[model samples]
Each structure stands twice: as structure tokens, then as C-alpha cells.
Target: MSKISTDPTRRALNGPTMGTRWTALFHVDPAIDTDPVRAALQAAVDEVDAQMSTWKPDSDLMRLNAAPVGVWQTVPMPLLEVLVLGRDIGLASGGAFDMELGDAVAAWGFGSDTADPVQIRAAMGRHRNTAALEIDVAGARVRKTADVALDLNGIAKGYGVDRLADTLVALDLPAGLVGIDGEMRAMGLRPDAAPWSVAVEAPDPARRSPHSVLALHNAAVATSGDYRHWIDVQGCRLSHTMDPARRAPLVAPPASVTVIARTCAEADAWATALMVLGAEAGATLARQIGLDALFLLRDPTMGFRSKAVGRLFCDQCPEAAAQHAQ
Candidate 1:
């Protein structure tokens, strides 16, 4: 007598959310119907977009923005959670990861509307503070002590990925890899009992390619870079990331910064924070906090170089160094 072993079927599901697509890959029994799973995943990301989108005029976040200062506005639980996390990271990063930069984002044409000079001047001249915002977690409400416009562009898509992961767990799926845009999270090992492979994109506006590869198991990764979205002003190309101090795009920043953390949301926000902090200061903070990050620097002589922090990225440093040495 002999025993037989069968491998589960591989399933890849995707749908649109947050101006991009959300993808989920997993292996499941061949007999299982995936329609319900697809529906659940779509619903999860749709809810996130409904609550946090800056482009949506009537989104929950926009409603909060319209509310009078010093008055509490009730928001959805998920939005509240994200606001709290954003505030915490804002304080930790010393305003490098600001959540109150909606005006600047809109002024610079990164939001739903086109850039306006009047609005740009207003955003640049106005003084703002992250401490002005208040969150009542128990009641799921938030308010502004002064005037502040909150934007979750740096974190929303990652949270959308997290919601997809949660939906899979609720659906009783054992293992999966989920992503929205470039942000990704891996729940468990693959059918072959190996970690998921994700690419760290090179900072090149001309083309899309990987700078390095990472093996992710029960973790998440995110990248913030200057090459993707930008605006041209007076012959200068500026990235979408805003400096809280200048209330404008960063003058000079690293080509890209990648971070790996326990959750996709954390990785996304931290990547932005580190990008604003620049390479030297960012690397120091990344090490102090025990975060795994890789900074891709632009070189006048060489094309690009890397400064890696924490244990996870150290192995990849050698290849980058070797290229520069050549």
C-alpha cells in the first residue's frame, strides 16, 4: 500500500482600491469557492478608501477637516486608529512624518485639485503644529484645538493592505501575501514552506526595476522615494513628499528609503519619516529604534549607493558596495 500527497491550488485575486489595485495570493484547497473570498477582500479595501481618501470630497477625513475647530467629530473606528498611529509617529519622528500637511499636498498639485499659487502661498506661510490635534480613542472621535488639515496619504494604502490581511484571517485562510500598490504584507510561509519574495524598487524615473530582493515571512515592507510622483517648478523637479518646516517638497532628499516592520502601515509611515530625515540622520535614528531600513543615495561619480541599517538590510549592502567600487 502507498500514500499520496496533494498540493493545494494557488489563487491570485485582485481589485481596484485607493486609485490602485489590491492583490492577494495564497494556496487553498482545490474544491473551495473563491468568489466569497474575493468579495470580502474588496469590501475591506473599499471601506479604507471611503474613510481616509483625501481625493474624495465627502470622505470621513474630509468631513473632519470641515468640522469647526474645538468641536469633536465622530469618525469611523478604522480612521481613528490610523489618526492615533500617525500622531504617535509624528511625535516620535519630531515632525518629520506630519499628518497635518493636507493643504501643502493640495497646494503642490499632489491632491485631487490642480496647484494654485494663492493656496501655495497660504500653505507655505501658515504655521502648524501636530500637537493641536486630539484623539478620543474610546469614543472614536477627533478634534482640532487649532486649525489643522489631516492627510493620510503616507499611510492609507498600507492600512488598506492590512485590512486585506485581516479579511483573509477572518475568512479562515491560513497563509497569504497581500499588497496595495508597492506596499506588501506576508502572513505565513508559501505552499513550498518558503518566505514570500518582494522587490525593493530602484529609484529611477525612466524605468521600473528592482534594486534588491527581500524574503518576507510574517512581516511587511514599504518604500518612499523621489522618482515616482513629482511636480516641476521653475525648472526644478520636486517630489510629492512635503517638508513640515518648509511646507513644500524637500529641496534635496535621498533617492529612496525602504523600511521593514511588523505591519505594512508602520513600514509605510517610517519610510516617509526616514526620507525626510535624510541619509545620515535617518540611519542613526533607524539604528537607535532598532528598525531595519535601507537608504539609496545618489552619487555624482557613481550612479547610486546604499546605507543599510539594522540586521535585515546589512546582507544586501555588500552587493550595492561592490557595484560602487567597480
Candidate 2:
């Protein structure tokens, strides 16, 4: 006679979306079939990509972009929700995280086409007037009061991650961790009753490695950094994140900024906002808003130095400070 183990089987699944991959991790009974769950996950992300992708000319976002200013455009509820949230974050971040930078993004080669000097000059010369977006929630429509090219690249993936988590819950599968690219959301604890462990990637383009780790349960985390995507111009390496005021890439920004929030969408947008604000101003805003954020700065001598705000990160600053100092 032999004793049998009663532990649930761990499962990991991933699929392509947004030129990257979306992933789900969980534990369930070994006998349970996962095909339905997998399909649901894929469908959830597909819906997001269809509605929000700037690369797709037929996407709802592009349709709105093409629409003449001041004319209302009908949008799906999901897209509407994202648009509303993007506007809110833009206001909250004091225009640091702008959605109306699509022109600048496309001109810089971060969008559908390669960089164009002619378009870049035009983008840079434009005055900074944040768009006035109007949302009719009941009608599920949105309109812009001015000429603005909207982009949701900063927040869409986070919302996609949220959808994955929601999909898992709808399927009656709790206890899971879901992510699109590096933006992640954690549901209930693992089968063994532990929070999901997520790594904060180091801002090193040469290699992939962890700078720190977070234990998340019912929370989400996201990071914005300079290393992952960039372009070279006149011997200068510029990050993909644009400065809304200048309508150009940030000249000086943190190596990376990581944010933890109740929703992945909030986390993702704030990370980008903080990157624009830099460590000093960002730390102030994070503290004022009760946000948990970690700023990694490039230090010539120490390699990387960190500045943390909010209780979650400050509580662990001693360790992070020591590690980053070296």
C-alpha cells in the first residue's frame, strides 16, 4: 500500500498578444480540463488588442483617432472604460501621463512606421494643449474637443491583465497570477496558501535579471523603464517614453519606476507618469496619493540607486537601499 498526494497540479499557460505574450499561472485539480480556461484567456486579450491596438488601423482606437474632432464616436464599453481611466490618470498625474501623444509616438518610430524627421519636427513644434475628452458613459461614446491623437499604450496592457484575472474568476478559478508583458495582477493565494512572487526586472538592456521581488495577493504591479525600448538619434540613445510637454523623448529620466496598485491599469499608468516626473517629483506625488512606488536611478559610481515611497516600499527600503548601493 502507498500513500497518495492530495496537492493540486500547477499549470502555466501563455499566448501571443500585443506583440508580446500574456501568461496565467495557477493550481487546480489534476483531473480538471484547462482548454476552456485557455480559450477564455486568449479571447479576453484578443478583445483588448482588437479594441485598443494602435498598429491596427481598424481598431476602435484608430477609428476614434481618425474621427474629426468634436464628433462623438461610439466605442465598446471596455474601450470606453479605458479611455475614461486614461483621462483620469492624465489629470491626476498633472499631464505627465498623457494619452494624446499618439502623433509624437508614431513620428518617433514607436508606432506603425519608422522614424521620420519631417514628422518629428512637426510633432515637437506643436504646443502642449492636453486634449479635452468627453465621455458619455450611458451612451458608450467618447469625443475630443480638440485635435488630439490618443494612445493607450501606457495603460492598455495593464487593463488586459485585469481582464485575464477577471476571466479566471468568471470561470470559477480563483487563486491565480496573470500578466501581459511585465504588467501583472495576482488573485488569491497559491494552493499552498502563499502569495504569488513577482520579480522586478533590473533596468539592464544587456541582460535580464531581477532587481527585487514582490509577494502579491490581490494586488497588481507594473514598471516603466528606459532599457527595454529605445532609439538612437544624433549619437543619443532615447527612451520610448515621451515627454508630453515637449512632445519628444525624455532627456533625463529614471532608469525605471515600479508601481504597485489595486489594479494593474492604475499601476501601469502611474509607472509611466512617475518616469516622466522623475524620482523627486514622482516620490512627492506618490506619497501624496498614497501610492507605492520605487524609483531606480542610474548612478555612475554605484550602478543603481533607489528611492522608494509609500509604506509598502518604504518598509523594505533598508534592504533595497543596501542592495542598490552596491
Candidate 3:
């Protein structure tokens, strides 16, 4: 085991938003300069951006999407790992979480370009049910019976956060928190022997306050909400989290789902899955699978109301019971 040190002050790096503002922090030996660590952290972000970003046409994900069916296209190991994990989670969630929604996302104007009804409709028409995708893990190849474009926006950032954390740990500095946008992962504890703290954003766009704060150690947290990304068409508001079955933006009112798990990837996917499940069904499913989750619903008179499911740690304490009426 590497010697855990407490002599150095923590170092942090911040940069212009790639899509959004991303921040990384690590506690390293005091004698080490910060520039090299900053460079390494930025390199990790660049790798994720090049391989997983949907905004980039030349990204590895796009290559896989453009490949001919039945032909195995070699892909970067990082992307391959993400796809494999994503497919498994999609199956486990009963299609609630899917990567084959590239068309839906692009049509909704959440992708690189503005929304095009024609492209949206075309993408919808080409939507190949995720169930039809055949992935050979041992072979490191994937085959789709029909044309289904892939998107990793839902879980990629969380995976990136995990990757950043892993990179920090590999450098022998395993104690710190890494967050991209709002998704985050914390390892070990702060120098004070307490867990790192994270604030859960309020679901309401009108409200800028944080509703709650969680203390986490060696775990990850991810939140999915429609407040940040949505489109208003005529009199209706359509969110980016589309219903894969309907091939359209989620018709239901917006809600924020937050998930906590052993890894950021699982938490991210599960958060999206719970959003698709909506308040009632999502809470139930979260309980069934023993997930730490919080669902906030838009109440007509109450503004935003919330519920907690499974095990959750807030203020460094665990809340028992799968569901809590808040």
C-alpha cells in the first residue's frame, strides 16, 4: 500500500466548460508541484472528450455508430468498457436506460446541432430496440440487427468522474473528490477524518439553493433533471430524457432523480433509469434493487417535493428503509 500522507495542502484545477464547468481536486505530497498533476487530470478529460463526446463527430462513439452492421469495428478500450457496462445496465433496468437514443437526443436539440424535425423523425424511424443489440463481451464486439444509433451522454460524465478518481488514486493520491458538472465521486476522507461533502441541487430552476448535503466516502453520486436541458415547442415543454419506447421526449412533468452507488457510472445510469420510471415506479424499482436514491417531484402547490429510497447517507449518517415520504 502507498503511504497516505497528510503534509500537503489539497490542490484543485478548474477550466472553461467543455460542455459545462468541470472541476478536479486531489491531495498530493506537498513537495510535488501542481502543474504535472493538472496536466495529467486534463489529459484524462481529453481522452474522455475524444472518445465519448457526442458533440464530436469524430469521437470513437460516432465511429461505432457509423460502422456497418454485422462487422466488428475495433474501438478504444475505454469506450468498449463503457458500452459493455451500459448494455448490462440497460438490460437490468428493463430498457429504462438505453444508449440507442442518439436519434432521439439529436432530434431534441440536445446533441451537437440544433433540432431538426426531419432528422428526429428519421432517427426515430431508424431506432433499433436495445433488446435487439447483440454484444459479445469476450469477443469485444457488438452487433445490431437493425440500425440503432448510440449515445452515452447519460452516463459518460459520471464514468469520466470515476476515471478521474481512478487516475488520482493511481498517482498515489487517493484522498479527494472529483466532479464534472454535478456528478461526483469521493475517495477516502478529508484530512479531518470526515467524509467529503456534496450538495444536492434543488430541482427547481427558479430556486438556486441546495436542498440537501451528503457526506460521502469511497462512493459516487449522480443526479438527473430536466431543468438544465429542455425544449419548448409551441405550448409544450419537452425534456431531453426521452422515453425510448415513445421515441419522444418524456411527456410527464419534470422531476429530479439522484442516485448513490459504489461507482459513478452505475449511479448515473440508475438516475436516468429512475427518471424514466417516474416518481412512483422509480421509487419502487429503486427499493427492489437496494439503491440509494432521492426522487423530487414537481408538486402543483408545493413547488418541489422529494422522497428517499433504499439506503442513503446524509450528514455522515445512513437513513434506513427503502422509501421515505418527505
Residues 1-326, candidate 2: write the lDDT tens digits.
Answer: 22243557899999999999999999887778999999999999999999999999999999999999889899999999998888899999999999999999999999989999999999999887765678999999999888888899999999999999999999999889999989999998887777888888889999999998888889999999999999999899999999999999998799999999999999999999999999999999999999989998899999998888877788457234211100
lDDT of 3 by residue, 1-326 (tens): 33555475778886543587567776666678877777777788789889988788898888878887777776777888888889888988889898889878988798877989898787667645756567677777776666778889888988888888887888788888898889999899888787888888887666667777888888888999988788889988778898888777887744788899888988999999989988788878887888888887788898777777764722123222222211
In order, the Cα lDDT scores of the candidates are: 0.89, 0.90, 0.79
Runs with alpha carbons beyond 4 Å of true place in candidate 3: 1-6, 16-18, 124-128, 313-326
Top TM-score: which candidate number?
2
Question: What value does the lDDT take at residue 168 in candidate 1?
Answer: 95
**Model 1: worst 10 consecutive residues (lDDT sum):** 317-326
Clashing pairs in 1: none
Model 1 segments beyond 4 Å from truth?
A: 1-6, 315-326
**Residue range 1-326, candidate 1, lDDT tens digits:** 22222458899999999888999999987779999999999999989999999989899999999899999999999999899989999888988999999999999899988999999999999987758888999988989998888899999988899999999989998689999989999888898888888888889999999887888888888999999999999999999999999999998899999888988999999999999999999998998899888899899898998889877877356433211100
- Ranking of candidates on lDDT, top first: 2, 1, 3
Q: Rate residue 40 of model 3 by lDDT.
A: 74
